[model samples]
Target: MTDTPSDPLKTTPLHARHLAHGARMVPFGGWDMPVEYSGITDEHMAVRTRVGLFDVSHMGQLELAGPDALAAVQHVSSNDASRLKVGQIHYSALMSPEGTFVDDLLVYRMADEHFLLVVNAGNIPADFDYIRSQVAGFADVDLVDSSARYALVALQGPAAARVLQPLTGADLSGLKYYWFTHGEVAGIRGMISRTGYTGEDGFEIFVPPADADRLWLALLEAGAGEGIVPAGLGARDTLRLEAGMRLHGNDIDRGTTPVEADLSWIVGWHKDAFLGREVVLRQREEGTARRLVGFEMVDRGIARHGYPVLVDAAPVGIVTSGTQTPYLKKAIGMAYVPTGAAEPGQTISIDVRGRPLRATVVPLPFYKRSRS
Candidate 1:
């Protein structure tokens, strides 16, 4: 869900295509990317109701091969990678010694002794270097930064499978959530994973750079029935926020530990050892002083990032991510607060531009799709 963007100097294969679609471009992470097409609200609703495509090629990728791949993955990741069977993916965090995030990532078990890591684009170089150093002492593990070798696009929403089924030979129905398969898509060989940041049913396709435009157009045409549109960073951010997905720069960062961020489910606590295992375990058993919590504005105000969160008119924490979601049409946000005050139904104050605004802590995932 950390779609803050990356590779500031590079553009994905679909850059020109985005321009042609009359997109408003913005600088994200390190790349020039579309902030919106049509408009943020329009694009956001399109994804919520029908389908939307996103150019996510700026994300970083790493390959770990050899007999020690699983060991290497287990060492750097919070999730238990050994439990992943072939074609399966698990959400994980690359942890530091203190159990803070190096980066949140996806661990794809491509094979028994081979794996692919999808990491944030801005942290690509840092992530690769860090992982390589961590696994340097391991026997027979080869780490390679293969970021430029592939292009990625996410076809997301309820109508995603309906749209993608016509473009790929792979059985979209058979690919369970977080699973992937190497298949032919729009006549090109690619890997399709049934995962998305929007909390919708969708697929992220990894294809060669040369085939990006082809695949992009093919999907647009295939999904025309569903009013498919090209969504950009603006919609992506709001969508993920509604889904309660953590943004790397805003919601979770080097300063925040996973447990404090309310993401302990990604940790494989039984793994005996890992970077930051000690800190994480301690926090797991004994809770942190402050915890991330979700809230909706009780008054008319937007509780933006960096705003002070107050208790009894005194500053205690800060807002990490907030927005007026298009689909939900309500102002919701997340913040870190004293653990005692983190429970839902509790009331808090957000310092909204010099004015203290009242808000109520609410359950996470402000929106959930009906899966009937």
Candidate 2:
């Protein structure tokens, strides 16, 4: 998930804490971050069975306010923001007029005239600038990059709420998925959202930078009895991959449209005017030439990003994300392929270092938590 270190990297509020704990630091999206602590497999299992904590302070947050916020948001995002009630959040994308993702983001409706957009770490500047330029047409909308106000962390896994319930006065049990509440976490006032990249049930807490260390420590201590472990970017990637979550630069990019990415559900087809609506409409009706789908190796090989995909001995598409999942214990991946070859039970070939390996197209979310 990290690019080779070249430019000086930015540090999060909890960078020192990570170093103190012997986390393997790497440069990811211009930020110095922990790739792993104890180990990726151990951390991944901790989240699958018990609980895991993650320092996600590098994520960017944008706050939109003013009377025309809903209208402005609708114009820039793919989702129908007007449907989001107060305290609710929805997954959407900031897109160009051509339907390619500028960034996939979560839109939070905090109030009638205020909202929040949580974007990926790497695309902050571009995402913010694009949103600003698109929404500038609205008569009354104010956009502010508010990433400086919060140091974010996620308490994810089966024991997430159990671990976090004691720290906050807010009723964790009452907060449904994709909803958030304002409360004090370990005595530090912040916003807590019941959303996460990991497929497991979790909570992402946003607190001011100054109080991050204390909050982090308090959580670790509180969840110690529940076998909570500190996870890093490595585990995060594998977990999200298993959960069928997209990593920006990998799974989807400027060349891929939401329709081709199989995220057309986020498009508000009923909306009068929104960025990229026409292109999305045309794709949905006319059908995209290619679509993103999940697959698993039928042979002894692991798929990685940018690996070539072959359909009937001909190169079709390429792998977007893949890994030998810690929990599932199998090599699984996602890729864009011809629509005819994207369905489950379809067999395909992966060019694993020039050796063609057989693979089977499978339904997405290679892993899902048992609800019972």
Model 2: how far is 342 from its true place, Å?
0.8
lDDT of 1 by residue, 1-372 (tens): 323444235689999999999999987767789999899999899999999999999898999999999899999999999899999999999999878999999999999999999998778988988998999989999999999999999999999999999888899899999999999888989999999989788999999999999999999999999999999999999999999999897888888898999999899989978999999899989889999999999999898999999999999999999999999999999999999899999999999999999999998989989985
> Poorest 10 consecutive residues of model 1 by lDDT?
1-10
lDDT of 2 at 34: 100
In order of appearance, the predictions have TM-scores of 0.97, 0.98
Error of 1 at 240 (Å): 0.1
**Candidate 2 TM-score to native:** 0.98
Off by over 4 Å in 2: 1-6
lDDT for predicted candidate 2 compared with the true structure: 0.92
TM-score of 1: 0.97
Instruction: Record all residue pairs in model 1 with backbone atoms less than 3 Å apart, i.e. clashing.
Output: 8-30, 8-31
* Total backbone collisions for each predicted model: 2, 0
lDDT of 1: 0.92
